[model samples]
Target: MAAQVLALLRALSGPEAPLEELRALHSALQAVPLGELRERADDLRLGPLFALLGPGSRREQTTLCVSILERLLQAVEPVDVARNFRVDLQKGLAHPSDSVKTLTLSQVGRIVESSDAVTEILNNAELLKQIVYCIGGENLSVAKAAIKSLSRVSLTQTGLEALFESDLLDDLKNVMKTNDIVRYRVYELIVEISSTSPESLNYCTTSGLITELLRELTGEDVLVRATCIEMVTSLAQSHHGRQYLAQEGVIDQISNIIVGAESDPFSSFYLPGFVKFFGNLAVMDSPQQICERYPVFVEKVFEMTESQDPTMVGVAVDTIGILGSTVEGKQVLHKAGTHFEHLLMKVGYQVKNASTELKIRCLDAISSLLYLSPEQETDDLLRMTESWFSSLSRDSLELLRGISNQPFPELRCAALKVFTAMANQPWAQKLMFNSPGFVEYVMDRSVERDKTSKDAKYELVKALANSKTIAEIFGNPNYLRLRAYLSEGPYYVKPVSVTAVEGAE
Candidate 1:
């Protein structure tokens, strides 16, 4: 079956083959045996079949050819098959036909994903250099595919080292500066490269690529801005990258974005990423120095807490949280009480309907604010809670009920976290326990014995820990058994049990 399928595929891929025959050939090849397919991959006719199929006008045929090449690569040894068709494949990289180049690049990506093939290719430095050169070629599509292939290959440290030593970075920068269409691709490549060998950024920085990327962040293209923001954020994550970003005036640009009050949606989306970037920077650098140098930026972030857009509020909340988590941030928020109160109010409002991600962020912000603010600000905190606590509690209870009935453990865990946080608040606790049958309802659901229900029980343990009221409510022998199961079941289960025990005490 495989021999016949390969023969048909080879014949259909020839120039003289009718399109109908090729379509039929593709249909027949789908059921071929793996071993037989491997044997056919070495057939001399396979090269022309792949080359012809690579550039076919029909998208289906082209996709099938690419799939065939990928399957063949998996089935056959790369060393045995690659040498025979290397020249033909390289030619497809520059083929005037788009279909051919696309399929060929797809094949290259697959080969790059294979560790042994990548190692073999890298050992042939000349061939590797040629491939790198193709990454910056004039054809945007081809260049993008080549860049993606390189990124996949560079997953290994040796391959990453090769990329750092090669001229790929220089070429990418040159394209970034000169080419608008490919700028996004260049930005992606920068991120991929940085992720693999963030230290390689030093080489780029020495060559002034960091400055170029910073400039690109201000580009009019939203995609370019977004990509540059992501890349900068990734770069700023590392100690060396943070130093480079700070030196490149990235913080100033980021500060301007937050304080500039730019109402552009694109800018708004990029702002949180930038804030996150700065958070990483703060983690790496001295937050005290950063705060002192950019006090106004911090102020503006606090001011943005009152923004109508939940997104802005979320970012501001997060930025403040990052700041407040540090001594410098705590000091700044302490001096900015009215600002913190307004921010907390916005966060409370956001918790009502914010996306899950933003809600998680708001939760983190609340935790941070609770930690940093003076005890005297309890009134402000309580006021913030009053505004949205009822709605959030209602929503959280519904989620808890839903998770209790669901089989997934993670959702139940998430519900428990929301409950525990609410259970921590005095007013929320009073409301929850006072609600009609709410206490017994939760306790009943908590005792269900499904594997997925462990999360519910674990959360019950936490809720019981948060308040003396809960400890008294569930202090029975049954609840105690649940607590022991949570503590001793597995290493992973013990933390929740400990929290419950501490809360109960």
Candidate 2:
């Protein structure tokens, strides 16, 4: 391939612009060793093709010259060649024929892919302005190709930094502002630039690109909104990013769209991304604020958790977990008839079969309930917790046991915490101490040498011992033998085996 580019560069460099008109250059270019020209990139020069690109050049001549130029872009080896081509490509981008402009921008897009070439592209200030302006060109082909080029350039660190340095972000913001069709592509471009490195992402953040993305989130285009959500998720990955979005009213924006999702054509399609953003925002921002801002937020998320799409279910669960973490969020969950129960049922079902991350997230959501401050644990929250305990199904018990026995210390602790928390209530105390295999499950982990696991187990056992139903294990003849096993102390341990589920935490 490199040899081919080198050969093409050689053949194209002859006595005259050998081919009289640009069209001839096209045919001759067909067999040009593009691969070899790229190999000898250091020797490449655009001087020979300047006549065709100059004023008074025929359209066909310019078109063919642009084609060859596009080919020259392939190697990206010679930094100087890329630098020199930019001026000509910028000029050709204004050609009357859309095809010529399209080819020129496409080649420029390809050229900026190289790290070294990206710096060269950014070095010339005027060249940067021209490329950005082309994004909104009258020719649709030209605008789309320009956007494609911008996005491609953003793929590397050098190019992304160039984007920031060259003020291309302002150009993108202008395109998005004018209601231009290319705005969607610009959305995609920002997502690309921010996706690569922290520096690029921070550049987007500080530059107010996130605000543009949030506005795009409510747009009528499903794809545009979805892509914007993707960017929001990226922002939500870091603490400052999430907080920034929340303060920027991004959470409010998402909630509004979701509320109308059922009635709106595009909003429903935006649900998955909306759910994802909700979960992320709730991580640091107040889920209470989300519910307060959008009264229907909880209902929307509850409905989504039951959707056939597993992704919807996962994000719904995530948001619900965050909601349940706060008092206000729990109240919303508690008031939603059967939704809270449905969550427990759905989560219990998924606990055994779901990926480890899902399992842990579900567990964290449920566990958060147990540790709430006393004031937050209202009567409704307590009753809901107790009710969840009273009606534990066979699958639920199996799920609990499965979690209790997990090799991952965090998961085991999360599972046991639920049981320990339930045992605190006198009414639910009997159920906790007497639940089949519950105590032994605790012992299995409690007896382990790992201090965290052992400590969690002792906590579970202590809760059981505090229950009035301690008599059930200590006094009842039925539990007499089981009690003797327990009295044998921590050293009298039972061996347990773990089956690893892929992608579990």
Strongest candidate by TM-score: 1
Please write out the lDDT profile of model 2 over residues 1-505, one tens digit for every residue: 4444344444554324545444554555576576655566666655566545655656656666767767765655546556666666667666666766676666666567656666776666666666777776667677766766676766666666677765666666776665646665566566656655556667776777655677767677787787678767766666666555667777677777887788875555678777767666655566666566666666778787677766777777777767666666666666766657766777766666777777777776666654444344567677777666433345454667767776888788778777666655544545545677655555454445677766676666665554455665435653454345446643456667999999999
Q: Which 10 successive residues of model 2 have the least lDDT summed? A: 13-22
Give the residue spans of candidate 2 off by over 4 A.
Answer: 1-211, 220-224, 233-253, 263-269, 280-286, 352-360, 373-381, 391-399, 402-414, 420-429, 444-505
TM-score each candidate: 0.66, 0.47
lDDT of 1 by residue, 248-284 (tens): 6677877776665466756665666766666656656
RMSD of each predicted structure: 9.4, 13.5
Against the unseen true structure, what C-alpha lDDT does each candidate score? Answer: 0.60, 0.64
Residue 6's lDDT in candidate 2: 40
Error of 2 at 452 (Å): 8.7
What TM value does model 1 have? 0.66
> What lDDT does candidate 2 reach at residue 87?
64
